[model samples]
Target: MELVKEIFQHLNGWGLTAILFIVGILEFSFGLYKKWKLNDKLVDLASILFGKLLMPVLVSYFALQLLPKVAPEYKEIFNWVPFWWGFFIICIADDLTQYWYHRLHHEIPWLWKFHRTHHSAPYMGMAMASRQGFFYTLLFPQTYVTTTLVFLGLGVPALIARGVKGLITMMAHSSIKWDKPFYDNKWLHPIAWVMERTISTPATHHAHHAAHDRDGIGHYNGNYGNMFFLWDVIFGTAKITRQYPEEYGLEEYQDDSWYSQVLYPLVKSDKPGSELAE
Candidate 1:
């Protein structure tokens, strides 16, 4: 347990950068990004890694700064929480919170603009995985949850939960069909059954990105899980197709600029019909 904690403790910026780059390489090798335009490249690659990467760091920095003032008595106060218990608590709390947060963005009318950038891409890959409006990242509840847990000295489980969630969400958003074999092999059906319901996968998640929602395959209204599909299943939002969508992204909002996608209210889209438009 100590060793695992130490390892995750060292998964710094460079390590995360290497992982995203490697995943980008995979998506490129798979030719998933063959149709990418310059704007697509800029929105997906140029800023995703750095802009999204700073999200957590900035949250942590600001959180740490304010925590000392607001809750100085609670500094490392939760250090006594057992590692496994902390893991379970954070795992359930963080993911469940996100499941609702994501669901609300899709279900609520006005909130959709904050999340529209993520669905603007015509394809899925490591690039799109981090593509989101600035306010979305800024207001993510899990960012505060995990950062608070870490500051309170549940750092080990907090980091593990975060890393695991990241890897799951990344794989779920990836263009690579790594989960294909699980559904293809006859003997693997049972494993596939549990795996699909246990964690987010390309098949389940890609369906969420389907352009048309009522095509018997798409479920843009559901499948809101990130790390754990179990939340969707339990909350009655899960959708499984075992098939990739023919087209990805939104059918309505097209040609939104990179700056508009990332900058949101700070930089609305020029398109009068866009959700980001003033």
Candidate 2:
């Protein structure tokens, strides 16, 4: 168990970055990124830097400042927890929280603009995985939950759960379409059936990024799971077609500038009729 924890920490630190980099390169090499506009490029770059680098540093700083003054005794407090049990608890808590946070952003009309940047890209790719507004990423509930759990002595399981969830969600957002093999092969249907419901797959997640839900393949209103699809299934938001959407992103309002998309209310879009426009 200790060995597993170390491996997860290492993987989350390096393996996550490596996989996203390699896959991103593949997408570029395959011309999958040819359609990416400059606006999309800037938004993705800022989002990756903010979400990956700054968010962690800020979160750690927050934990350090808050924990010492309020709950010094709680630091590493849950270290006594058995690893697997801790993993199970964090696995359910983190992803389930993300599921709701993600769902609410779409269902709530007022909150939609905050998350609209994520669904503005016209294609499916790794860079778009974290292309959320600054405030949207900052306010993600699961991130704080995981950070708090780590401070509370569940670092091992929290990190493991985070690492595993990170890999699943990122791959699901990649342009590689790796899940197609499962649907193409007859022998894998049973496995695919259980797996699709168990975790977020490219098909299911991509459907949520569809430009319009007019097509039967698109289900942008639902399929809000981040790591686990079980939340969507249990909550009646799941949709599995074993197929990718023909068109990704929003059907309208594609002209939102990168600054407006990333900065949001602090810098609303100048484009008239844009969702980000005040």
TM-score of each: 0.92, 0.95
- The C-alpha lDDT values of all candidates are 0.83, 0.88
- List ranges where model 1 is wrong by over 4 Å: 1-13, 46-53
* Model 1 per-residue lDDT tens digits across residues 1-278: 67445544655435455666788998898788876777777777645765656765888676768778888888898899999999998998899889999999998878998887788788988888887778887888887877787778888898777777887888899898999999999899999999999999999999998888766888888899999999889989888989889898878866888888778788888887877887
Summarize candidate 2's per-residue lDDT along 1-278 as a digit string, tens digits: 67555545677787788778878999999999877988889999999999889998888887889766888888888899999999998998898888889899988998988998898899999989999999999998988888888888888888778888999999999989898989999999999999999999999999999998777989998999988999999999988888888899887858788999999999988898877888
Per-candidate clashes come to 0, 1
Stretches of model 2 off by over 4 angstroms after superposition? 1-9
